[model samples]
Target: MFHVGFVCAEYRRRDGDGDDELVGGSGLSRSPSRSRMIKRLESLNTVISSIWWVFGFYWIVVGGQPLLQDAPRLYWLTVVFLAFDVFFVIFCIGMAFVVFLALFCCIPILAIAYAVASTEGASEDTIRSLPKYRYRPATVLSTFNNLGMEEVLGARSGLGNNGSSGELFLHSEDSECCICLSSYVDGAELYTLPCNHHFHCSCISKWLLINATCPLCKFNILKGDTLV
Candidate 1:
């Protein structure tokens, strides 16, 4: 807070083009990482303000004080001017703080709000109105309960992650649920959508609710569709 005013004051003197170029190309406005962008800007502003504030003090001490020993008339005049300069600096610092805070702090927020708000297809109502399903695949034991030892062993073999080392008893185009990026397992609950796409129960539910579309085919689930 000590040098906040000074830093803000110095900002008025800085080149707008450099910052504009950096911000314009940064893609922060189109990103969900907008919060991170703001944090970085605040940190960078503090560092820059410190540098400018320290240099200002250094210049005043090293440059201004050296000129006071010439003569009485000049000495008094210098003293009066220095006093006025100090007051002027203080006033400028206050005004500059308000201007900079208003200008710099609000730019990102407003830019990002407009950038994202202009987009479509996502809303609280869409998410809240989404359907959910709790799918349950048959248990392996039930399928193999009355089977022979060889059949039971083969069923156990297909449970391998890639089915690379096993007999691959359970194999299909839907072997893996893309929404969760995971392979289906026996008794794993899932949602089979109206588009005939299936995903882990929680995975597709969350995804569909967020975008209201099938993660695979982009089927609009909110438009008279439901979980199968």
Candidate 2:
């Protein structure tokens, strides 16, 4: 009776195998997950490329319309402007590509660095021992005060001449103080730095008391001075 039962079980197993094959064997039953992902990526790339092409086409069609008209001056102006726009777009795209490439290349380098740091058992003392790249706030503040003191004294000496501040002068109408974001008024007290940059006397004095460099160009005022 046991032998007969075993034979029946074997027959059932064979019947199940035939049904599995008919439904599609185990090897071919699973979905193509990787192929679906590739399709998705391809579709995304196609959509982006299509949008870029459309934008370029529209720009060319609309931008050249002025050139096709009879106004010669307008045509030349439009041409120049379009040329600059194209150049700017190309430059931005190139910069973005370079940034993307750098990021892609840095991933593996960062992973390796982290792995090495972990394996070597990095400590706080070792990190602190590494060469620092930042400047101390105290040093920056001292330099600012030192540079501002000389200008402040000069402005005071010039103040006695007919109430006109000698350290300040009226600059061009278009000139603006970068620190205060104010346009230069006629006869307003202005301070001109050694770098030929001008600013409001009050605004620059306060700024120099905190930073020794030119606010706009960042030229160091005390770079050349030394203890003789």
Q: Write the per-residue lDDT of candidate 2 for residues 35-96, one digit (tens) a residue.
A: 45545666676687668656765765686665456566866765576678779899999999
Question: lDDT (0-100) at residue 24 of candidate 2?
Answer: 73
Model 2: lDDT equals 0.56
> In candidate 1, what are the lDDT values of residues 1-228, reduced to their tens digit?
634644553453244434756777444353335445545667787898768757765655676645555465765665576678679999999999988987998888898787444323445554433333332343465346546545754554344323232222234444688865778775565445557566665676566545666767767665644323
Off by over 4 Å in 1: 1-173, 224-228
Residue 49, candidate 2: Cα error in Å is 45
Candidate 2 lDDT at 197 equals 71
Q: For each candidate, what is the lDDT?
A: 0.56, 0.56
Q: List the residue pairs that clash in candidate 1.
A: none
Candidate RMSDs in Å, in order, are 18.5, 27.7
